[model samples]
Target: MKKLLFGAAPLSSRAADVTWLLFRLHLGLSIAIGAGWSKLVNLTTATEAEKMVGGAGSPPDWFVQQVADLGFTLPSAYFWAVLAVWGEFAGGLLVALGLGTRLAAFQLAVQFLVIAFFWYDKPEPLLGMYYQQLLFWAFVLVTGVGGGRYSADYWIWKRATARLNPPAARAATLPAIPVAG
Candidate 1:
């Protein structure tokens, strides 16, 4: 007989479910603090936008310098600044809300990778922001199991599924339409 793993099924299920709930909340909040909050604050201030590019732009000096490092100038840098802020702020909000966790995580991960390779190029072992990015990347990669019971993603999925394949009784309640000639 195969050994029954995880001791008991029900206990294991509850444990997993609780763990997912906590994980989703913590990870989502972390993302919000890391990016969303700053972007949100920046949104309220004109100078913050200028500060972004360190030249009357919202991009940070380093961010703008990176653009110049790659020979991109002016409006391109500004555009990229906007993209970065949105990637962080909007993506973070969605992840925190569990409204589009996977998409947000993926977008953030891509942005981090680009920053790591082109913007900072941190030394081996990766400390500071690089380390944080690494953790965020790993978390998203390891926990790509949609969303938990406490997540909006879960409810949305359930609702969509019910709508797509409703029960027979529910379906029967619909009024018959007239046939076209």
Candidate 2:
């Protein structure tokens, strides 16, 4: 790999962590533009289903009818649509900020899964599909672990751990207690 890259050095864990953080930050910011920001700007009504989907070509009337025929609740449908859109927006924001990364990434991952698998006619077949797949995997990573050292999750974890477990130096400074027989 290094030979093919014109004497480039292998990336270290620190570099990888930085790269991961940057990758999520950039992707989250970009996704937010359309997925998050657009929906937010247009959001006025709590039950506005049409606003969830941007541009033209919302699901056909026949499809809606079919869903209804299958006993799909109208309010539930709208509620989910609005939820997904807001989730995308909120997820992107949280991921970018490295706050609530796991939850945000999980939500985004589910959103992409629905789009890539349910929405796409052929799953993982095209470059676009591959992009979504990669993004999904990346989100999964963030979900499973987190945004790494650069994230708020990391800071919170470190603080919590420090509070839970004192440093050796600090522990050594404490007076020894006599044990009760």
The alpha-carbon deviation from the true structure for residue 140 of candidate 1, after best TM-score superposition, in angstroms, is: 3.6
lDDT of each: 0.59, 0.66
Question: Which one is best on TM-score?
Answer: 2
State the lDDT at 110 in candidate 2.
85
Clashing residue pairs in all predictions, respectively, total: 9, 0
Q: Which candidate tops lDDT?
A: 2
lDDT by residue for model 1 over 27-61, one digit each (tens)?
66766655555554443454455535433225455
* lDDT, candidate 2, at 177: 100
How well does candidate 2 match the true structure, expressed as C-alpha RMSD? 11.1
Per-residue C-alpha lDDT of model 2 across residues 14-116, encoded as one tens digit per residue? 8887887788789788777555555554644456667657653233344344334435588666555556666777789888877777778888998777666
Which stretches in model 2 have alpha-carbon errors above 4 Å? 1-12, 43-73, 120-128, 168-170, 173-181
For candidate 2, the TM-score is 0.65
